[model samples]
Target: MKNLDLKKHYIFFIGEELPQPEAHLVQSTNAANAAANLGYSTVLVYLQKGLKAIKPANLARPFQPRETPTELVKYYNLHDKLKVVPLPMPWPIDNFRSKFTDSNTIASKYYLPFHILPTTKLVHSRNWNFVKAAIKNGVPAIYEHHHHEDKPFELEIVNNPLLQIAVTVVDSIRETMIANGMPEDKVIRLHNGFNRLFMQRQPEKAAEWRQKLLSNERSYLVVYAGALQQFKGIDVLIDVAIKMPNVQFVCAGGKPPEVEHYQQLTKEKQVQNITFLGYVLHHELASLLQAADILAHPHCSGKAATFTSPLKLFDYFASGTPIVATEIPSLIEFKDTRAIAAWCEPDNSHKFAECLKQVLETHPRKIEGYSDSIEFVKQFSWENRAAKILSYVEESLRPLLIT
Candidate 1:
C-alpha cells in the first residue's frame, strides 16, 4: 500500500462480463479501447456473478482465419495495451437475499441492484469490500455511472470518496453525486456519443439497407431504433403510424420477446404501415438511418428518460436526417434545439404525428435549419467523448503517476 505501480492504469468495472451490445458493454469497451489506443496501460476488471441465466460469449469458439468479426471476441488480442481481468463467482446469486458462502461473498460487492427489475433486490456494490483494495495501494480510479434504478453504492461514494473522478451523463445525476458527498468539481457530465464503429459506414451500405428496410430506396421513412421497453413510447409510435397511413414507420432495435410483443400489438390494433425489424447491427443500422427521411425518438417521461442520455440520439444526429424527439430533459440540455431536433411534448401522439407529417412534407433536406444538426453533431463522436474523459483522467493522474 506504499509506493504504487502506476505503470498499469486500472479500471474496475462491476458487471457481467458479456460480449458487446450488453447494457454497459459498448460504453465500457469504447472507454477502455480509447484509453489503450491513446497509449495508456489499461486493464478492465469485470466482476461477474455466476448467475445461471447469464451467458458469456456464445460464438467465441476456437479462432478461424476466415471467421466473422462477430464470431470472436473482437476487443481482445486486437488491443495490445488493453487487458481484461474477469472475476467470475463460483456460486449463483440472483438477489441480495441469496445466501453467500465465505468463498462467494465477494460477489455481493460487485453486484448493483435494479429496483425497477423485480428480480434484482436491495443491494449496493460491495466497493468497501473489493474496490477499496485497488485504491488502498494508491491506484487512482474513475467511476463512470449512468442513471440506475437505485444506486446503493452512492452511499459508498459518499462515505469513502476515493474515486479520482466520476463521469456521469445527466445533470441530475451529477447534482445527486455532489449532494451525496462527491465533490462538485470531481463529477463530470459526459453525454453518450455516436459510436465510431457505427458512424464509419461502408461504400455499398447506403444502397443496401435503404432498399432492405423500406423496399424502396426513395421512400420517405420515419425510423425509431432502440429498446421496446414501456417507457420508450413504442405504443405512441404505433399510434402515429396509424394516423399517417401513407408514410412508412420502421423500428430497428428490440429483443426477440419485446419485438414479438410489439408485433402482436400492431396486429391487434390493425396497424399495417409500421414495420418492426428486430435488432439490426450498427453497420446495417447506420445505413438504415442514412436512408431515412426523418429519425424519431419517442421517449416518454420516466426514470430512464430523466437521468440517462440515450446513444440513439447521437446516432440520429450523425445520420444527417432531421430528428423528431419528445421534449425530454436530455434533449433540452443542449439549450439550442432549433438546429438539432424538432422537439415536442411527451405522450402527445396527435402532436407527434402532426409534427412528423409536417417535417416529412416540408422535405427537411431542403430546409435551412435542418442542416445545422450535422455541424453540431461533429463534436458528439465516440472518439471525441473518449478523448474528453481521457484528458480529465490524464490530468487527475499526472500528479499521482510515477515513472
Candidate 2:
C-alpha cells in the first residue's frame, strides 16, 4: 500500500466474522487487508446483525479453518490496519422473518450513518443491489462482479449512469460484461491471487503430513485442494486415482458429508492410494501443496469452471511445483504459452490420466515455456490487485465521491 495517495478506502462486504471459510469471505478479507497493506485506510464493514463481537481468535490466526465455527467473533481487524465493523441486524425482524430482496434495500440506509466516513469512496463485492443502492445514494463505488451464467448482465446494471466501474475476476467475465453493454473502459479484469502463505517456506510439519498421506515414502504424490462439487470433476480425479495405484492422491476440501460421499464412491470403485483429508485449513493447505509432488486441478467445463479464477490454481503456482490441469482458459493462462503446466483436454479419464503420466515422465530438459509462467504469476499478487483497484478509484471515482 505504498506510494499511493492518502485516502480511506471503504470496502463493504455483506457478511459476518473474520474468516467464515467461504472463498468470497476470505477473498474479501484478503482484498481489504491488501488495501491496508498498500497504504490505504481500509474499513471492512460486515452488515449482518447479531454478531458476538468476541476477541479476535488467535487459534491458528494465519490458517483459515475449513468450516465455520459455532463460536461468535463479532469484531476483528486485519493487521490492525483495516477496521472491522459487524453491525447487528439493523431491524428487529429476524432473518427468518425478513422479506429481503437484497441487502441494499434492507441495509443501505444503515451504511451512511454508521459508515466510517461519509466522504470516502466505497468498493463493494457483495450483492448488486448494495452497489446499486450505494450509487443511488451518491456514494462513489465500484462493484466487484464475480461470475454469473444464468443470464446476461441486466440492462439496468450495465446501463446505470451512476455505475462507473466493475471489477471482474477473469477476462471471460469482462467480455461478458462488455457484450452486455458495459463500456470496455469501465471494466477492470483482475484475476484471483494466491495467498502469500503458499510462497513462504514449507511448514515444519510437512514431513509428518507427507508420511501420513503416503505410508511408502517413495510413492509419488499429487494433490487436489478445493471443494467437492459435481462440476469440479472430482469424479475424474477419482478415476485417475483408481488407474494410477502407485501415485498417492490426496484431496483436501469439502464438508464432512461431501467427504463421506466421495469416500463411499472410492469404496465402490475400490480405489487405492488416495486419501481424503477433508477440509485442510488455509495454512495447512500451503504445506500440503509443498509436500506434494504435483498439484492436480481436474475441473471439466461448466459455468463454474468457465468464469472462476480458482484460488487453488494460484496456490499451486506459488508452490513452484509442477501442475497437471484440465484444459481450461483460466488454467491455460497460468501456463502462459509455456509447458509450466501439463494442460490437457481430458474429456475422459484415460486422457486426463495419460496427461498426468506424461508430465511425470517427461525429461526435465524437454519441457518448454516454464520460466514465463513463474514470472507471470508474480504480478497477480493480492497486494498488486488491491493497489490497482485503489488506484483506479483514486483516479477515476474520486470526483464522483464529492457527494
Candidate 3:
C-alpha cells in the first residue's frame, strides 16, 4: 500500500479549558496525539471554559496526578507532530482565524467551533461567536459529545459547511442526529481510549491495588464511580447495600450537596459498609477499579440517558473488571458475554440486585469473563485508535496533498 503522508492541519475543538486535568480533557489531548501519529500537524486549542481561571488548590483533582501536571497547560508528546494551544481569554473568533491563517500554515484558522442553545445546556453566549466564526472560515470543525445535551447542538452545527466530523460514543446518538436531519456519512463513531500507562499496567500490580482498597474483611467489593446525580441510580446502589448487608459497596465521584444529603438516605436505610471517596485522579481511579470485584454503572434514564456514552464504560473494560450496567444502547455494541458486561434496568432495585448477585454467585464465571474482557479490550487500545484515525486522515488529505 502506498503511504500517503501530508502535514495536514487539524484544529481540535475543546469547548472547555485545556489542561484542566479531567478525563474528557485528556481524551481530547490524546485525539491530538492520534492526529500527529498519522503524520499530520495537530493543534489542540482550549476555549478556556472558566477552568483556566480556577486556582489549582481551589479545584479538585479528578484522578491521581501522573504525567498530566495540575498546571494550566498539561502537555505530553503523543508524537513530535502535535502542539497544544491554550487561550486564556474567551473564544476570540477574529484572533483564532488570524492565527490559524497567518501564523499556523493551515487553512485560515478560525475560532474553536462549538454550539448549544436553550436545549443544549452547554452553550454560552461567549462560545457561540467562536462557533459561528469557524463556520465562516471554512475550517473542518468537529464537535465532541460527552453528554446527551450535546445531541441537539451537534445537529445544529452540522448545518455549517465546516462540519466535518461529529464524534460521539453512544450508539443511540446517531438517531438524535438523524432526527435533526444530518447525513449519517458526516459523523464518526469513535469511543474513548485509555492512556497507555493505565491500560498496559501489569495484572499483578492491579491485584495488589485491589487488595489495598478492600483489605481482608470484605468478601466482595462493588464500586460505582461518577457524579452522584439522580440519573446515576445511586439510590438504587444504596438500596442494594441495605438488602445485602454482607456486601461492601463503594461510591466514588465528586460530592455534591444533593449527594451529601443522599448520604442521609444511606444512613436511614442502615447501609453502613458503604465507603464514599470523592473524585480521584485517573491513575488513582484505576487503582480503585483494580481493587473492586465488579464495577456498577447503574445510570437510569427514561429519556436523557439514551444519548450518552459514559467514559467510565471503557475505563471499566480497560481495568479488566466485569461491569453491571443499565441496558443502554451505547453499551449494546459490546455483547460478548465472556468479555461482555452485565446489563439491568436502572431504577429497578431488584433487577440491579439480581445482576450483582449473579456476578457474585458465578464467581468463577466472573473471573473468566474479566480475563477475556482484558484481552478483548486490547483491540480498542490507543494504538488501534491512532491507526483508525490515521486511516481517515490519510483518506481526507491524500487528494489534496501527498508525500
Candidate 4:
C-alpha cells in the first residue's frame, strides 16, 4: 500500500464479526475521535470468523466469516471514507500458520491445533502483517482484544516491534503481560465506554421497555444482562431469585444450554419472578437498563469473567441505576470498598441476596451519590475515548513523521 499521511490513524481488529459491546465501543469511539480531530480518518478493518458459540447459531449462521465483513461495511456505511478489509483465515488452522506460509499443506489445514500452538498462528500472520504494514508506512493501527485470555499468548504479537494492541481493562492483565516479558509500553488499555446514544436517556424508549417488564408483573425490577453461563455465576443469581420472590430478576443476553439449565433450576427450585429474554438487540439494551432498579452481574468464574471488565458496566453507569456486582478485580473501578455498590462473595447465593436487599433498602436511585461514576463516565464517552486513542496513534507515529 501507499504511504498515507502520518497524521491519520487506522484500527485493525482481528476477531469474530458478532457486534459485541467492546467492538461497538471501539467503532463508535474511533469515529467520534476522528470527527473531533477534523482531518484524521479512522478505518476499522474487521477480519471474518464464525459466529461466537455464546450467541445462538441460528443468528450466527448467516454472518459466517465470509459474509459478516460486508454487513459491517454497509452497517457503518463506510464505503468511500472508511476502508473494510476482509481476511478469511480458516479456523483452528488460521490460528497456527500465517498467510505467508511456505507450504500449501500447512496452509490448507486452516485451523491451528489449539494445544500445540497455544496461540493462534493465523492471527499473528494476518493481524500482525496488517499492523506491521501500517506501522511501517507511518500509520498507527490498533489490534483489539474484546475478551481476555483469548489471546494470553498474543504477547509475542503485541510486543512484536511491528504492531500496537488496544486491550480492555487493566486489572491483572497489565501485570500478566509484563510478567510474560512484554514491554509495559506496548499494551494500551482502553476501558470500554458507553455508546454516545446512551448519554441522552431516551425516556420514551425506557418507558416502553419499562412497561414490558412491569406490566402484569412487579414494579421493582432487577436485571442481569450478559452471557448465561456458569462463569457468570447465574446459578448464584438464581439462588438469590429463590430467596427474593418479590424482586423480578429479568435475565437478558445470550444463553447456552447450561444457562438454560439454570433457568430450569429456577423453575425446579420453584423460584417465581425470574424471566429470561434470550438475546436482545442493541437499541433495546438502553430501555431495559432504564427500566431496571439494579444492574446485577454475579459472574464468579473464568479469566474472561474475572479479569476482563464487563462492557455492560459502562451502560449500567450510563443508565443511572445502582449496581450490585460480585467482588472481582476488574470491577474495582466501581468498588468504593465501604459504600456505593453492594458487593458480595463470588458465588455465594446468600451473600448475593443479602447485598441485593441491602442495596434496595439503601441506595434509592439518587444521582448525586453516583456522580463520580457519572463524571468518570464522561471521560469514557466515545468522543473522549477516541481523542485519547488518537493521541496514542499520533504518539506511535511520531518517530516516523517525516517533517
Question: What ranking of all candidate models by TM-score puts the best one first?
Answer: 2, 1, 3, 4
Please, what are the lDDT tens digits per residue for candidate 2 over residues 286-368?
A: 77777777778888786677776677777777766678888776666655545355777745778888877887776232112
Task: Please name the candidate that would achieve the greatest lDDT relative to the true structure.
Answer: 2
lDDT by residue (176-274, candidate 3, tens digit) is 655656667765677776554445545565567556555456668889877777777888788877776677888877545655777777778667877
RMSD of each: 7.6, 6.7, 8.8, 8.3
The residue pairs in collision within model 3 are: 62-280, 62-281, 63-280, 63-281, 63-282, 64-281, 97-109, 101-109, 210-291
Candidate lDDT values, in order: 0.60, 0.64, 0.57, 0.55
Which candidate number would show the highest TM-score if scored against the true structure? 2
Candidate 2 runs further than 4 Å off? 1-7, 16-18, 47-80, 90-94, 100-104, 112-119, 149-162, 363-374, 396-403
Clashing pairs in 1: 109-126
Q: Where does the lowest 10-residue lDDT sum fall in candidate 1?
A: 114-123
Error of 4 at 15 (Å): 3.7
lDDT tens digits, residue span 63-170, model 4 = 222222444433332223343333333345345655544123222232222111121111211243444444444334455433434234444445555454454456
Model 4 misplaced stretches (Cα beyond 4 Å): 1-9, 19-39, 47-140, 145-168, 215-217, 255-259, 301-306, 337-339, 365-372, 394-403
Could you give me the TM-score of model 1 versus the true structure? 0.76
TM-scores for every predicted model: 0.76, 0.80, 0.71, 0.69
